[model samples]
Target: MDKNEFLTVDEIIELTGFKKQSCQCEALTANGFSYAKDAEGRPKLTWTHVNAVLNGQINVVAYENERPNFGAI
Candidate 1:
């Protein structure tokens, strides 16, 4: 997979409109994005998740425990 597959810290900052990492993570979490944190504690969001959310392939709140359909992409 490409390294650019994940949203960078700057992109996450811009997306959530938050300068603080904690706040950004919280905002993403509130929006139902399942993310992992890097060694520096920065949130890591995959393009797949973003695409799934944007394409309405899955419900943010309801699909918390469900795996997104990777084949659809």
Candidate 2:
């Protein structure tokens, strides 16, 4: 969790299998994701934050899937 290492949006998308969207950004932020604007003003997430989310230390509701209802057999 080096503060110097930062992941780009594309990396996050690839790692999390999430489609690029504003909603995803919002979800990440809500889930304890720490981001800072790069020189281009693009949001850059710290590896610490990414790992936190991946390790379940940070929970994102939007990324959670609802349990399937199978009805009665």
* Top of the candidates by TM-score: 1
lDDT (10s digit) by residue, model 1, range 8-63 = 87888888899899999899877777789999999998999888877888687577
RMSD of 1: 7.7
Assess every candidate by TM-score: 0.78, 0.44
What is candidate 1's local distance difference test score?
0.84
lDDT against true structure, model 2? 0.64
Clashes of 1: 0
Off by over 4 Å in 2: 1-4, 15-24, 58-73
lDDT of 2 at 40: 55
- Which lDDT tens digits does candidate 2 get at residues 1-73? 6656877677767654566555556656656665666685556777776787779876555434343446743
Best by lDDT: 1
Question: Model 1 compared with the native: what TM-score?
Answer: 0.78
Runs in model 1 deviating more than 4 A are 64-73
